[model samples]
Target: MERIPILRMGKFLLITIQVDMHDTTALALQDDLMAKIARSGARGVLIDISALDVVDSYIGRMIADISMMSKLLHARTVLVGMRPAVAITLVELGLSLRGVKTALDVEKGMELLAAALEDGDAADQD
Candidate 1:
């Protein structure tokens, strides 16, 4: 079985999708990421999909699901590097990805995650 690599960066988890994802692969990623978040106590997730040139409805829904699941596990998820066509496809497929945060690139994604974590910390203090 193929598995996506999830890297730990301080209090965040970084996932760079370098291969085209099949349904099984995306499912496995969701499971793996949830477990990683629970075990590592990561506060944020950053996913870079720049390498992907295409996205079907399944993959788009999976991305949205992953973001929602991460939130349930108390982690903020930021999706980065989406191509215009992929965005159009997702919209056409009616997967609004409502709860997923997005950035134009990894640097901005990282900044978003960092700021989100800081906000979470501030909320915790209150």
Candidate 2:
């Protein structure tokens, strides 16, 4: 069984999807990511899909599910590197991916996560 690599960077988990998404792989990723977030105490998740040129509805839903699950686990999710057609497909499928933050690239995504984490810390101190 092939698994997607999830890298832990400081308080963030970075995942770069570089292969075609399958049902089993997507499920595994979701479970693995949730466990990592819990065990690593990660504050944020950055998913880079720059290599993926197409995104079906299933993939879209999986992305949304991952984001929602991470949120429930107390981690913010930022999806980056989305292609134009992939974005259109997501909208066409009505998977609005509500509550999921997005960025044009990995750098911006990291920045977004950092700012959000900082804000969260400030709120915690309040």
Candidate 3:
């Protein structure tokens, strides 16, 4: 069993998946991430998946589910560092990742997340 580490930066949670994930590992990550978000009251989540070369349908759904779950918990989710090949594979596999947000890399993901959080703050203030 592999445990994914969830790091906290201010009000955001950062998870860099450095290992090839099996179904069990992906499920575990989903569970662990939700727990961490609940415990830390994180406002955003950044998932870096640059290291992963393959993402099957199950893994694709897991990613989308994570994003939806984060939104349900009032946290914005940003998937980052997806390789071009992975993107094409995902599209061909028919997993649009419909409601999930994505970025090219971690730095850009962080910026995008910050902007989203700022927008949420503004919405709240209004």
Task: Assess every candidate by TM-score.
Answer: 0.95, 0.96, 0.97
Q: List, residue by residue over 1-126, the lDDT tens digit for candidate 1.
A: 789999999999999999988789999999999999999999999999999998887888888899989999999999999999999988887888887899999999999999988888999999
Q: What lDDT tens digits, residue by residue, belong to model 3 across residues 1-126?
A: 888899999999999999988789999999999999999999999999999999889989999999999999999999999989999999998999998999999899999999998999999999
Q: Is candidate 1 or candidate 3 better by lDDT?
A: 3
lDDT of 1: 0.92
Candidate 3 weakest lDDT stretch, 10 residues: 17-26
> Which residue pairs overlap in candidate 1's backbone?
none
Which of candidates 1 and 2 is the stronger one according to TM-score? 2
Name the lDDT value of residue 38 in candidate 1: 99
Candidate 2 lDDT trough over 10 residues, lowest sum: 92-101
Which candidate order results from sorting by lDDT in descending order? 3, 2, 1
Stretches > 4 Å off in candidate 1 = none
Winning candidate number (TM-score)? 3
Error of 3 at 27 (Å): 0.6
Among all windows of ten consecutive residues in candidate 1, which has the lowest summed lDDT? 90-99
